[model samples]
Each structure stands twice: as C-alpha cells, then as structure tokens.
Target: MDGYQVYRDAMTKDQWQGWWVTWPLSTRVRLGHVYDRKSDGVRRAGDLAARGIPFQREHGTPDGTFIYDSNESVDVAFKASGKTPAALSALTEADAGASVTFTRGRTAFVVFREYSQSGISDVRGLSHALVSAWWNKEWDDSLLAVTSVVAAAGATVLTAAEGGAVAELKVSASAGVGELGMADLALGASVVRHSALGAQWTGTDVTPFYQVIRLRKNWLGKIVAEYGPRPPGRGALPSALPPLLSEEIGDDPEAALEPGDRTEELPFHDPENE
Candidate 1:
C-alpha cells in the first residue's frame, strides 16, 4: 500500500491514542505512539526499557500527549506488542509530517511549517537534497541534509515537521560522527558565505573566525582519519577540547570569534590575506 494509506489506517486505529511514522535513517522507518496520559506512556516505555527494547521518548505535545517511538521491524514489533499492555506496531507509513508520497522508486515528503517565501525555498531545496540522498543511499549526504536543516532553522532541536530524522541524527551525534559532521558543514558554509561577502562585510573582519573554523575543521579531519569514523567502543565520544570550548564558541560565529585572537596569528593564514 501507499504511504498515505498506511498513515490513514494508523491515525484511525483504535488501539493507540495517536500514531505516526518517521524515517530515523533513509534505510529504516520508526513507528511512534502517543498516549493520553504521561504516567501510562512512561510506564509502558519503562516496561519496554526493562525488556531491552529500543525506543525513544519525545517531548510532550502541546496537548499533553506523551510520545514513545521505536524502530523495531514489523515482526519484532508485533511479537513484542504482547509483552507490554500497549499495542505495538511497525512503522508502516512514511512520515506524516512530511506527507510524503512513496512511489516505486522515488519518495517525496512535505514539511508543514510556517515560513517566509525564502525560508520555504530553503527547506524545499534541502528536502530535495534529502530525497536525493535517500534514493542514492548517500548516508553522508543524508546527514548533511539534517545539519543543513538545523543551520537553516538556527536551532539545535528540530521542528515537528523535521522530526522524522531526529532519532537517527541523535544516534549519530551520540556516536560522535553526527556532531563532528555538523560542525564541519556549519564551518564550511560560514566560510563560503564570508568569502562571498568579501570586502562588503561590515562589523569585525571575521578573518579570525575563519581561522578558528579552519583549525577546528582540520583537527576534526585528523581525528576522523586517526580513529576512523568513530572510536572503537561505545559511551561518550572523545573531544579534543573541554565542554567550555563550545560555550566559548557559542552559537553565533561572529560573536564567538573576536578580533586579535591568538589563533589569528597562527601559521595557517586566511587565503584572502595571502
């Protein structure tokens, strides 16, 4: 059946308070459930956790709906459904938020968020990129799509319309690859924009900012090359700098990189300066 049909059936199902579907990764889909009460949802999720089932709890909706989602295969979900009092289901639908149409080969999903014309255009472009990445099995490009959306939205957390990819990105970030990749993409995009502005740039030259980004990017590259993707084992990913470094950098590149920073004088000078 088509994605819309699956979505309609899930939404109309009587067993769960609410239901939705998402693509945690291009290759896998997750089924999500909403409950009428937090306690019921928490208890059910806790039971799953105790049984070593993989699931993720999302923030409550505006109406106090508690959410829990899992990426288990259809057979597994059905088998596990009896373990808990709640009925479990496989992710049979494409992301409802995206309203995606899944045909034989191509998939197109919509994002339902209010945005200006420019914002809409940006999201549409990134959505196309995401679709292309999915079709081509380009995991890095898929990751890039997620980061680009975050950059475009200027937020760490994604909107409901963009929630489909959150779980997978979180898993990747936990593994260290996601965060490093995001940093690289953001820095690269900033450098490109800065270069495009050229002398027309106002405020601080931000040449220092470019240097910092490059140093960090190069360091990240080295780390990847050394460790190969992620470290050997699981747990918190290693960081070259302390958490305070992120605080110092803050979110704004302009504010983070002031003039006359020590790194500005480092051997790697800006190409424009050379």
Candidate 2:
C-alpha cells in the first residue's frame, strides 16, 4: 500500500515518528472533555472513553470533543453547577480544577486527554506495604493512583488535571505497620506551560454541570494512611467495646449478675393490700 510505503520512508528519516507517538502510556491517562447525551453542543468521543458513545456518520472521537466551526472559530462552554454564594466566592478566589461530564442518551462520557480531570490516572510504583496494608484487595493496582487533586485558575474556573501549574507528589512508604509514608514532593510545584481557559477559550450554548472539590497532598496522604492497617498485635481494651443492653442479659438472673450484686424479694401481697 502507498500509505505503508510512505510510513516505511518516514521511518527511514531520523526525525520521523510513528504510531508509538500517539500510543497511550497508561489507560488512566487524561484524555479530554466528555459530552453527555443531553448536552446540546458538544459531541461524544466514542469507545475512546470506554463509556462507548456511538459515532455519528463523519463524526468521531476528535470531532466530539472539539468542533472547528469557521463561524465561531470553535464552540466551548464552561458551566458552574454551584449555586451557593460560597461557590461563587471560591470561583472568584481561585481558578478551580473540575471534572465535567455531560449525558448522552442516559450515558455520560468525556474526552480522554492528558488535561481531562475526569479521567483516571494510575499511581505507579506503589509501595509494597502501602499496597498490602492500605489498598483494597479487590481494587486493581493499576487503577489505584489517579488525579487526587487539581487546582486551576481562570475567570469561569476551568478545572484541569494536566498542562497547568501542578504540585507533583513524590511519595514513598516506610516498612512496618502504622509507619507514616513520606511525601518529599514539592508543594505548589509548577507544571509545564500549556493552554488554559482564558483568551483562547470561549463559551458554548450547552450548560455543563460540575462539582467543586478541594484536595491537597496532606489530605491525600492522610486518606492513604487511614486506609492502612493498624500495627500488628495491637489489641483494643474491653472498655473500648460497646456496652451491652439489659435486654441482652441471660434469662438466669444469678448468671446475669456481675461480681457485685444484691437481690431482694418483695411481698407477694400487691393486689391483696389494695
């Protein structure tokens, strides 16, 4: 095939890149925004999101996330689902990182891109102790590490996971139970320069519903640590156990009595006296 020949020729060139260039390193890698069935303007990025939005004729994954309208240049909308005054205040205070999902035919989907906050990201090289002690046995290790927190800056508060100023964590777990994992990663670390919501971005007709979640490294570490097992041989005291109710007592009153007890028999003349 001519295309194959062209590929062979391109490979001959030192600068030529191939399929691996576009290959995804991880399944959880951020892709892009997803348009739901109900969403008016945005298109769905089929099968790519794993949610499987069917592709319309001539419309595919890239087309769904990005539409190059000559008239509008491109259509994009930022919707803030928060109705509270504080929500507005937080938006005003700092650019928020958000995960936006629109529904399509009762199924929700988003674009898979490096910047998509909604997408999952794997935390690789997890500590053995962290895995055995903290991680749930049922959960897949590859799916464990994701974008735990994201903070964005902009007028409408476009939340982004990648391609913005980010604090990258370099975490490691210590051996033994109950030992705290160390986070030597820098706080407020800077991310590579990339497109952000602002001059280059505009709005669309579709109203996007999203939530504002705040997470920090310390908070994430706390969560990871909390899930960890307690140190070995550490037993709870009897006092720590919940107290039993009187109804739970045995039928035999003598058996039910504790170390100290006094029993008295009243006269049987209750009705006779009356």
Candidate 3:
C-alpha cells in the first residue's frame, strides 16, 4: 500500500478531522492562500472571498484540520486519477504552450508563454504594460483590474513557497523610449522601458528576488517583443519540507516505506529534491 494510504488508514474519523493531508505541489500552489499557520491546516470555509479563482473549498471538517477538503485538492486528485494519463494533466496543459496576443501598431503579435515557474515572470511584464497603457488611455481599461489580480496572486504563490509575505513586497516602474527588435516584432522598433517588482524574503537569507516586466513598444505606442520566460532555478527555501505535512510524515518517513511505494514522486515529500 502507498505510505500515504497507510497513514490515512491508521487514523480514526475524529483524528482525521483534525488534519489536512496533501501531497502534490501543483495542488498546494493552487490552494496556497487558504493555509493557516496557526491552525496548521486548510480553512473550512468554501468562500474564496477576494481570491477570485473559479475553484472552491470542499469536504472541510468543522475544525478545519483537513487539506483535502479544498476543492482544488479534489480537482488535482481527479486529474491524477486513471482517467488521465498525466499526473497533473490539467495544470500541465494550462502551462504548456499557452499564448496571448497583443497588438503593436496595425500588426498583431502572438506570444507563447506558460505560467509555471518563471512563466509568472512573463505575466509580471504583461501586467505592467497593460496597466500602464490603460492609465495612459492607450488601451482598454476593462482589463486593468483583472490583470492586477492575476499578477498579485501569482506573486503571492511564488513568494509563499519561499516563506515570504506578499504584503511586504516592493514594486517600481519606469518608462522610456528605446530601439528594440525581436523575431516577434519588426527590426529597429522603438520600445517602451521595462518595469520591475522586487520581492524580499523574511529569513536569514534576505536576498531579494526581482521580477522584471518587459513591455517593449513600437513607435506607434503598441506593445511588442514580449518573450523569454525562464525559471529562477536557484533559491530553494532553507527547509525543503512544507510546514503543512512535516508533523504527519515526520523527519524521515520514506525509510519506512515498503517496495513499490511511489511517494517519492510527490514534491516536498522528497526533501532532497524540494
């Protein structure tokens, strides 16, 4: 039997009510906002409030001690089921080969991008440019609020994984004219400058992580040259283990696993790789 299954079977109905068990990184990222450090589990409320995502919470115990109670957990598990070939098919599909279109002058440009890892970096830049254009009456104002929310949520998730608070993050933007050209845009295009968001961590290692939003614009004041989103491969949190599961799994739970156990595939389950 799987180690997680073994652990679950060992618990009583009441004991299970006081704990939230989860084992996937993608699911955890989707439901990051609901976790409470003091309660040590997911909140029982189904209301996402200001989070604004389509998913909701489910199966929560009265005491709010279960992580699987969240709707995102159920969704991830459904995707992981035999019904799908990939473990996180929906999430991976969304992240794989996604693109957005923005216009520069009379020409339309399609930019392929993803949202996992450093793909959030691309969002940061697009959000900056869209908001700037909206403020300057160059673009539709309808997308301003939506763009802000998505960018903020992405930043929160990325920083939360590193134990950083999003509220303390500092952001700055600047605009200037420059000559820029890329395969996606015409040669010698006049482009607007980039904006950057600086995120600082709250532990012994206080190095700040900077997310630069590049929104290149042509002479016609239209966006161009938005590409290249890569992950910040370094800077893993000092404690590789996620705080939510540390107590349930212990310092070294894998040693007790029997053969054929696949818990190693779960992120944060394998401390070395996390």
Task: Count clashing pairs, candidate 1.
Answer: 1
Residue 8 displacement (Å), model 1: 36
The TM-score, computed over Cα atoms with residue i paired to residue i, of candidate 2 is 0.15
Tell me the tens digit of each residue's lDDT in model 3 across 162-246: 1111111111111012321111111111112111212111111110111111122231132112212212222432222224223
Instruction: Report residue 142 deviation for candidate 3 (angstroms).
Output: 27
Model 3 C-alpha lDDT versus the unseen true structure: 0.21
- Candidate No. with top lDDT: 3
Q: What is the lDDT of residue 141 in candidate 3?
A: 22
Spell out the clash pairs found in candidate 1: 98-110
List per-prediction Cα lDDT, in the order shown: 0.20, 0.21, 0.21
Candidates in order, TM-scores: namely 0.15, 0.15, 0.14
Candidate 1 local Cα displacement, residue 207, angstroms:
35
Error of 3 at 154 (Å): 27
